[model samples]
Target: MSPEFYTISQVADILSVSKETLRRWDNNGTLIPERDDGNNYRLYHKSQLEQFEQAQLLFQSNWNDELNIKASRPYKMLELFAGAGGLALGMEKAGLESVLLNELDKHACNTLRENRPDWNVVEGDISNIDFSEYHNEIDVLTGGFPCQAFSYAGKKLGFEDTRGTLFFEFARAVKETNPKVFLAENVRGLLNHEDGRTLETICDVIDDLGYKLVNPRVLKAIFYQVPQKRERLFLVGIRKDLISNSEFDWPSPYHRIMTMKDALKAGELYDCDVPNSEGQKYPKRKAEILAKVPQGGYWRDLPDDLQREYMMKSYFLGGGKTGMARRLSWDEPSLTLTCSPAQKQTERCHPEETRPLTVREYARIQTFPDNWKFSGPISAQYKQIGNAVPVNLAFAVGRSIIKTLNIIEKNTAMNKKKCA
Candidate 1:
């Protein structure tokens, strides 16, 4: 039978709150949990959760049905900053064909080329390349360009003003290719970057280029089959002429939040147990200290002296340095992966092991296929995986975009028949 009572971790997933927040609620007598007789673990009865609207939504979700999405026809796409093909691979799984991809990193390019030999991988700086040849031939243009501010200088934003930034190169590609649609992916901080001037200028530039900007959304990867708490901001735009016929919809969330158990084990997400691979090991003293941390525990879980010894000056600093000496919990999603697993500020220790996550483990957490290999040193591989969009998250977005494009295709065909 499915679960009637949920653990604190499971409830956190449904309610979208941290365990610490839930604990606070417990302390305040907001919602008390019934203790499990077997192990004295806290378990919230299902009846206690109906008060939360988010919990109710999970009860009535239709994620399995949403997976029926498919393309009506082959839609061509072009990409910039295509690192390790994460977004492109996900889009392909959703039925979009990549005509070309541009990247400055030779390693990421090699990884792409090695995986998909037929893909047209162009390795170079975006500004040095020309996208004019693909004009009108491409259906969509996508880029995860770096977030950089364009100086406002008390003037209205325009295409010419974005010249010095990578976003400008992305805009230049959109202007050159005139794709039916385009997407610019960035960190969620972009929404508030420069006190929101950056996004405002981006909107103004989209207007100048003859596209209608959909309200951008910062999509949480965990909601879209990724077993990590990563968020990426996606800005979807449609050409002005097709705006009337286009009906874009964001992908529906899965019924349940995926956890680390689902990711690393041979469960619903994968067919086999995670393969043994090379990973970074902690020094003897560091490993001994980290081993004291229980699953889901961080520096605060340590003894006072160990905490002081490990955190050093950081222990006295303000703000919850939760990521320090952290050990992931199997029952919860992994924290967002970073460029290197051993980074002190963003440590991602294994649940039961005292080592940094392996490269393959990092790839698995990012929702990359087990077979997909990175072509670089271990550190470089981590960098590529860390910077990638979660493949399943991209698949969800790609399917939604394809659904919109299918409507545009049918509407255009009907119009052509009427003209004939």
Candidate 2:
């Protein structure tokens, strides 16, 4: 069965509200929590949370229903930076055909080839590839290009001004392919990068390349059925000619919040418990110190002496530093997975066990299916999975893109008949 109670911190994270706000609500009698007898800690009941609009989505019977949005006709896609096939797999699940997938990492390309032997996985530098062959043929072009700062060499940044950056390559592909729509994903920090000029420049470049940019949005993965609290910024652009005919909408959030329980157990997300896989281990001293941390607790929960011993001079520094020495709670979504689970600064120790989460567990948290095999050494495997867009989240976005295309296709068919 699912959890019946949640701590204040858990509730705050789930509702995307600050702890201070939760306390204010409690004081105002807007949303009160029950007090624990042992320590008098505030605990919120699942039933009480249902009173909230965000929480109410979880209780609706149709919350997890698949939109099953399908392509009205044959639609092909060309994917760039196809890391470990996370986005490609999700788009494939959404019924889009993968015409080509390009990646620089050999391990990722191998993983893609091993999993989907039929896919045309191009393994090389993206700068060397010619995308013009697919021009006006492919339906969509998608990628998560790495963000790089643009040189302030010009007053008004245009397509040519962004020539050296990875985003430029993404834009160049969009220009060459001239797909009906293109999607780009990046870290949430991109929204405010370089005081927002970076994003403004990107928008200007998209316009220069003959596309209409949609209002970019930062989507929370937890809201879309993934069990991690990851946020990604998405930019969708349509061809100038098709912009007037297409209507795009963001995907709806899942009905209920999924916890670590759902990711690891045979619940809604997976049919079986998380499979055992290789993972990094804590050193003897580190393991001994972390064992004292309770579920949902972090470095602050340690005794004063141990805190100093573990943290050293850094403990004296300011900032919450909550990710340090942290243990995840079973009833709440896991903190965003990092490239290294056992990193000293961002530890993701198991809720009950003292060790770090294994590879399969990490994949499960990212909503990668159990059968999806990642190729490479342990470190490379972690890097690939950690760097991936959550599959379910991508699937949700892909469905929205498909919906827009469906509308555009219908309108085009009607116009062709009228012209005839």
Best by TM-score: 1
lDDT of 1 at 56: 81
| Model 2: CA > 4 A from native | 1-10, 28-30, 34-66
Off by over 4 Å in 1: 27-30, 45-53
| Residue 232 in model 2: lDDT | 96
Question: Candidate 1: what lDDT?
Answer: 0.90
Worst 10 residues of 2 by lDDT: 57-66
Candidate 2 per-residue lDDT, tens place, 1-420, comes to: 236887887688668898889999999999999998889989999999887776765556343454767889878999999999889988888879999999999999999999999999999999899999998899999999998899986598989889889999999999899999999999999999999999999999999899998999998898889989999999999999997788998887876678899999998899999998999999999999999999989999999999999999889999989999999989788999999999989999999999999999999999999999999999999999999999999998988889899999999888899999
Error of 2 at 113 (Å): 1.0
